[model samples]
Target chain A: MTTPTQQRLSLIDVVNRCDSFPYPSDPRLERLSFLTFIVDEIPCGRIHSSVVPHIVAFNQQDRPVFHITETTISFMPWLADYDSRSDAIAQMLNIWRKAPKSFPSLSGWRDELYGVYTLNTSPLTTKGGAALAIERSACGIFGVHAYGVHMNGYVRTGPRPHEVKMWVARRSATKPTYPGMLDNMVAGGMGFGHSPGYTVLKESMEEATIPIEIARNAVPVGTISYTKLSKDETDSQPETQIVYDLELPADFTPTPCDSEVENFRLWSMDQVLDSIRSGEFKPNCACVCLHFMIRHAVLTPENEPDYLEIAQRLNRRLEFPGCKKWPTFKEEQ
Target chain B: MTTPTQQRLSLIDVVNRCDSFPYPSDPRLERLSFLTFIVDEIPCGRIHSSVVPHIVAFNQQDRPVFHITETTISFMPWLADYDSRSDAIAQMLNIWRKAPKSFPSLSGWRDELYGVYTLNTSPLTTKGGAALAIERSACGIFGVHAYGVHMNGYVRTGPRPHEVKMWVARRSATKPTYPGMLDNMVAGGMGFGHSPGYTVLKESMEEATIPIEIARNAVPVGTISYTKLSKDETDSQPETQIVYDLELPADFTPTPCDSEVENFRLWSMDQVLDSIRSGEFKPNCACVCLHFMIRHAVLTPENEPDYLEIAQRLNRRLEFPGCKKWPTFKEEQ
Candidate 1:
């Protein structure tokens, strides 16, 4: 294994891995294009060309679920309401779940539902409901924007502000996604009914065995967003991670309480940077670390040549819609 | 004037004021397009359609400086090196400076130089050289990317992280640009020969009576970028501001030392937010305050509905090239 001081990947390289979609500067960016996936007149997702034939076949059923055109794949006008669209999509996804060989992404089917929202509608807040809800695992295949919360737990080690150490979690080898990869101290998908702060508190206890009092101290900092396009162009996932920072006491240590994490380790900022440069952390989680570093002044304009580019890439604007209003979250005593 | 609480602008509204360019979602975005300004075969700026006639007239001189095509306006191939291009552009600008009526932007020319740089070359760090240096006031007319440094000085009042106050500055009434506007505690353009850190320190002392020891403690955070396109489409300015945060002692107060600032006042977060919602702060300075609030957890996901959008807008991706590397600086005793 290479030492921590060995040649390191530039910060931009790590960001590019997460935000893998072609930039405007890239040549031939049009070669890997997808059709817009519209639901209830809102552009909610994208559909890869390879998946069009399967959708076309599904449309040939006694009742067509989708209306396909050259440029877009939209829900049938008859499926107007949220419940009808979600049920129809769930029924279709279940069919694919059974034939896992044909739809590889459905092999790890998660029954947990994720809200498909527009700028005006949110399952958690809006009086008008989301466009639809789909199984969490199927979100990437549909190219829908997914939301999550990730918290960086750290401790100030010395008198100076930059002297700090971070709590890092390694994913359990048996986990379905990103098995054995490094992650932030606590992270979880924003399930259909949960607020971001609620998710953070819940994940903190479930994943890190933190007490409610300590976990409630997590502060919502900002967000890091990216659109990850799979190499085969079969998956288009535009995701946003609502980031938080929890400054733990120097004596406090995290213990894993769930199968999601294999173990927890506290490392200095240098160790974390080396791990990030070595691609040990999951791409999005690495981005979260970079976000924390940038905000806390670990990486400055003088030290990181790609400082500005990294900042912009960490917040790539998605064409699809997000919730117009976020739900207010309060800790349950 | 309307009170801060009376029909206040949303956070997204404040962000839109700074980044007022056409997003991909805008339908009529093509109408306000400008041709790319290429220097040494690199896209460094833009040229408004109305200004093409002026360049064409200059090209008619005995020794043409520009080669204008349908899509782009580029410097002549003969002007290869940095000196030749800077001298030639300076000569042309001098001619326009004499006829201030025709070139209205040059009317307030300060005789200060600003570097025109590409990704590979910076006036401060690159050994090769910058593309050229032009008059600071005329950068907007040519649509070049300008750089600056903005510092947010704050004091922590309570044990809690969000319980902090910010130092705000009011621009002098006699200033040329945005006269009497509200600004951050300290801000200045990235002049030709200065580094961002150096600019921050210099401006800290020159604008506000900050000692070198205190200014050196300013921590470099991330950056904020935006493309401000004028309503008439005559000016296209893409700017990047390197952000800094300084934690001031509760006892210290800043007094305006120069004519650039009228005075400095420390305000509570509530007052600052009210001013921001009322559009009382200068556009870019408002963004800086928003960024500071975000990092310090003053504005959170639950409280700010437009949190995600605001974060993305604060770091809008600019197409023009920026410095590939920044210079390192040490505080002088």
Candidate 2:
């Protein structure tokens, strides 16, 4: 109601509200069969698009058995019903590659394979856990916008609430997606064949030159999830980021050891928030940063009018799934 | 929608929808000027009843300045605008006490003083930093229902990753409050003249035998806010709990160190949740326990259909004020 200095512009708003896009309202998308993506016997996601033809063509290969109904497509309860879940996913990927117009390109650093299942469900606990597949993080934009884990590693000065600083990274200009955007000190996807813990450790070493000893100490503070609808409207991204905070000593400096990052800078909290407000950081990373800020009490419910909404929306209840209570993930074949 | 077994509860049907009292349609209460309770010039609550005569009487007593209007009553911005903020609050309390029928007894254990402010704002930062007052928590049920903070501490045994245990307490039967109601392992109101951090420490020592070393490691995970209308329809309670989780070792036993708690038991997570679902735990404590369950990954967003709704409702935005930008609270005389 008042002239807005920063009512809804907080990092949590831009990234979190993408879920507000109404998929249920799109008749064309709805007319398409809703294939529920399942894990641990729970339906985590659904194919909201008209991908029946693709499913049919891919099924012709004598792989991936699915229940074909007028209103839905469901993977059979048995993962062995298909030769291999990953192989079937690969076939779909092959189809997308053949017709670039249908599915967009896997962009930038996200070209690397990432995990796309409900976090850490297994055959011992789930009927079809063995059948889940993996894909490049970018492909999830068009494919199933699977719930993925994201970790942020930061450093502080001294103990006793000394001056606080955050380790921030700048994406390489050569990166195809979000190139040269501001990022957390260290961030990474829960790639296929990796637990959130493993991914954090791996990313700590690769993304920033953080030692295993320090990265292991990173506390899993909380998680933030959002359903992002990209500007081009080509894909819908439903993701859940498992957030972490690793406090470092006064002398700790994060050096970029991976090409994904152009450089790393230790910036004050004010500087980080300022950049976030100015839209310098990638949307999701900014949200990840804000998650840290709120948890750290740097951003209190008193200071931000949208604090309640931001906090609620930060973990928007997806009609989909999240990895909590999920069993430990199985090894990738 | 399906018969039973907790699906997404319609807002009207929430197990905890406490606003069932028909206040909006009640002309007597509606006709009240709805005096606003403001801190640091931010409106936090309103006197729901038509208490104009009482306000006028309190102001006549050579103390507490007030702005009386046909539509609202407001605190003077400066104590010089009155005698003193505490004096004004005391006068209001005095008026309520004298008219025993007008305002009921200060029931339960909340005769204790609590800080009611806009959070930690500074004199240089706020318009009325020095004009805030302390009040009895029980009185808040009728007065402003000021937002309060509650903390939860839990423990997990190392032997069985399959099993998780939470320390829960039973209030003494002889207590004035909801005696014998199951409470959090450590729960306390943010009293006047106390910071949340400082209060957590004080309550930890008094309620549980947790060593400071282990208690200091407690994490301020997040907060849960709710508005409850007493079943008897006498009062409306709006509260916000800043949740904490202090994990204890496998062998740690919580000894009730004070007479406030008659007993302490290390409850299994299932037992804790079952008690909550059955409403055996104090409503606020039950809600607090649920907050911990959701965070510890024991209650995944997947298994619980109401995960999103529960999460959102846990921090329902109050129509009144929240402690935002409040300077560190000044002590009461």
Candidate 3:
């Protein structure tokens, strides 16, 4: 008689893996003084953090970028006299580009945009001053929150939906961040111009070679948020990641179409669990996978003792400015 | 061409409907003293509150149920010497039954049991001393959090997968709580001695006449939790609802096997939204429907502005004894 060895992971181990999400300790985010950047007496962004000193120094030569008093910084409304208000911003950004030491980027351009809001409730109030590039917002250059979309792609197998096979992506070794680490099959930033739905569809096709029809059917599950105070306490990185789930047919496979992803492979739940335990998957992507597992009955409440805690902790409260003026492509389309 | 009067809700209005979850306001919960109910030095339940005066006043003739002090109240551990805890609890309940005013139930029985726990690691600690009835716990008589199962039963329809039909139930007029309000097709308190899986199966059969085989397939989705402080500020109703989802065959219909439900109906998403906007469904049940809508992709982030907030708020943080040793029927089986 053969004695069977226990192969199933204990629920606590799975919950622990989900709980082990890593946060980057960027010292720049800490101890920032709040300086509201106002446009025509309305709030546009939090412009003057401790980084304000650096911004002030960077603006020494170019067209007096800001008129800063002790507590507040206001864009010179005369900027409207310029050809484009974005040009005024571009001039400042271009100055920083020359030094490149202050603002670091492998690719100089972050084509994606984000909304900057004001107290005045109308587009006439913006005066061409309501947009920021994708990457700079994470540094909280102007103290604004950023948004994105992440997806958990999976295939079902075994008899009677008994097993989950996750499609995992290995980040390209040459990628700027978390290179060679594991990731979800598709993930992308939700920039100013695109809706969460449009962004997901676009990213799916570009990153995973997933067709538009399949991507359009992706489910909007929920969100995960975090407010990371940079290691120096000068910037606040407040981000909200809207999560999605795309269930692929058993025969479906994901292939990387871009340099961002090195390749894609399907792994059984146990193997995924092993990799997570070994600290392999990108922290946030691991959380997305865990959230999917909890919802799909893969981790039953009975098996997981911390079930309630895990569910509540997955989507933490984000400290982003309340998103009233944010526009999306989904609604516009 | 006739101008079509707008009949459908905008995505934001639907999202706001999900956001309007209300919590009961009670002054007592705001200032309750913490009295740890310890078992072998591991804190188990918060045994006593300002409500203890009321419990003491109600149990005047009982076998002195508690050992109360200025800061704490404890059960007589010697009660464990008795073979059947149900009998001892039954005797106290019988005394309350005679008064009826203090312990009121239309059926005079909750018929629900919740696990009582001690921290020796595993089910062996449950020797019948580890369970309490639902009503008593609600009164803070035992200081334990009650658990239940709530489900969303949906039927898919329409071309392009654009439509979803939900199976909703109307609460019976004579039901003691939230009478005539709408509810999920399947819901039942996870009374003592049953696992989450077992209870879902049992409740599905009794509540919706869902066949056992189909009920067995009800997926363990996630959980929702809230603490309701009573109107008079005397009692705290802390509950952890383990939510489930069972996709019914499009042809299958639920019939009321018990009078707890007046009837079941398959309503399109629009009708459900209207009823929810009018505050017709029990608050938790309405949120569950939104959770289902989100997971099914009926409510997308593009359409709902508060998409992130709604998803995070669905599983509110619960204030129960952290569930480390709670035993469920599934674990036992």
Candidate 4:
């Protein structure tokens, strides 16, 4: 009889897969080529060099939305306010959405809007300084900052990290992005007008069929950030994932309530590590697992060679402004 | 009845106190002036501009230890090997130690050596690449990366973040640095020849009188790094503190076993936060507490405005080299 083989991965390798960009301290970054996405004279995002011509094409439109320079693509000075800019961008995206072959990034057309705030403004606080809100799918194309909530739902068999088991979800094969990939039990984008707390509660119930009473216990932990340069080099995704931890009763099992998740499984720490090593987990989802392990002490300085670097890289400080406060649903109304 | 007023601080305020340096991504950093400390042509540390005159005085010696330039100070070509470099630096430091009036940083004279390594090497891996070792007290003067372990000893009253209470230590009034300030229950320097695991266990007992069996349960969670510029502009402290979390039995109480600490007390999360706000805790120690809060979900994305920034700042990636793998005691013997 043959024994089963186990796959292994270095902790740094797992982190590098998610945070693929060179470190900000690296000298090579000074020579890298990318165009700036400017709004109100503030450099807010990194637009891919390949996407410059497409943006320049928008400037030729009857009502030009953007003013294009050699190294920067900025909103026209006339479109100063939030609603005007949002409407102009949305109109442009809708036109691009019509031609799926030309603009592949707008294919999903997530109808949901993601707010782009300046460093001085947060969604949950003052509303005036918000630069614009655009379709969630277009966030990557423009290299704007995006936000989401990822929660590790787990059951504790003992007090130690080794004894803890996590509830992992498998995305439905029919889903648009990262289909059939492993993911956190409860995960959702922080769409405009919703807080991380609200997103956690909403996603937990919709995706996992978890009761609100049980999901209310989901505690907001910290965040994991990365600027993932798409494999094709056409998209730059600078994202912040607000992480949470929910300890569920061992007796209660999670069942897929929506088409988003294919199934859920209670996995041991070893199984999680093995799956991560084998590349069965989504890059960001794997990063979320690494964050969980670091907090739970399953991965420590003794066992992990890149403990400090991993911790720092997991929460990379993005140059573009992000929402310091997540607007609650009640506040939005 | 009138209630006692409680001191309060924003989480960003606590993190800013430790990571006071301009971020590496900040444009203003390019204009900041400092000289790089070069070891065997590898940029290893930062030297305060004020200390350049003193380093120049050393070059006037019959056998100069360093080759100085306007922007950088490099070790002399004659001192090519580890032993030669270590001895030459030590000799100069000893002379400086005699006249503490001029070289105030050498006054502590702890006699513990800190190894300086290139980015390509670690103390636990190849031993030959260690450029030199110098007294710990003078590490800040040279701006070399120093290491330490800080463990938070706490008791879990419940599963929630606020349900835990920490064992806080008050440093002795007679202590040279941050005298009478609040600190973690157990903390100690990661000397030249010790791993973080060994340091945590050793410090737990020496500082808090914790038993070996109990101390061994301290789980290494993560690390907090900062580049602390001295108030007088005389020293640059780029240090990394390996952080651990120890959940003690509810009945167990920590007692001061060494003269470093005057007393220990179990403090509520509120009390700890208040103390940190009141400036009763050392800057780095307060950062460790914030790290605990972030991990335990006390300070979350919902509650802290600077949640992402604080998390990133707490683990600032040092430009200089640090030991990736710490040397075990067995290896040293």
Q: What are the candidates' interface root-mean-square deviations?
A: 1.4, 5.9, 3.9, 1.7
- Minimum summed lDDT over a 10-residue window in model 1 chain A is located at A120-129
Error of 1 at B117 (Å): 2.0
- For TM-score, the strongest prediction is 1
Model 4 residue B258 CA deviation in Å: 1.9
Weakest 10 consecutive residues of candidate 2 chain A by summed lDDT: A324-333
Better of 1 and 4 by DockQ: 1
Who is ahead in lDDT, 1 or 2? Answer: 1
Per-residue lDDT tens digits for candidate 1, residues B187-278, read 99987767788889999999988999999999888999999987676787889999999999999999999889998899999989988888
RMSD of each: 2.6, 10.7, 7.1, 3.3
Per-residue lDDT tens digits for candidate 2, residues A61-180, read 554566566645666556532235555666566666666565555422244554444444555533233235556644444345454445555565543222468888899998777899
Give the distance in Å from residue A311's predicted Cα in candidate 4 to where it truly belongs.
1.7
Q: What is the lDDT of residue B8 in candidate 1?
A: 82
Candidate 2 chain B, run of 10 with poorest lDDT: B17-26
Query: Interface RMSD computed for candidate 1 is what?
Result: 1.4
**C-alpha local distance difference test of each model:** 0.85, 0.60, 0.64, 0.82
Model 1 TM-score on chain A: 0.93
State the lDDT of candidate 2 residue by residue for B1-333, as single tens digits. Answer: 123564433322333643333333245445333455554455555555435566677788554577766545667666532226566677577556666565554423345555444544566533333235445644444345454455566555652222468878989998876789888888777655555556677788888877788788775656766666554444566666776667677777878898989898887887776666655667777777666665555654435544544554555545554554333434321
- Candidate 2 segments whose C-alpha is farther than 4 A from its true place: A1-8, A15-42, A50-71, A76-85, A105-131, A137-149, A158-163, A324-333, B1-147, B152-169, B174-178, B185-221, B225-240, B244-333
In angstroms, give how far residue A174 of model 1 lies from its true place.
2.3
Error of 1 at A248 (Å): 0.8
Flag the better candidate by lDDT, 3 or 4.
4
lDDT of 3 by residue, A154-255 (tens): 886753333778889999999877889999889987666566778888899999999998887787777766554444444444566788877789888888
TM-score of each: 0.95, 0.59, 0.74, 0.91
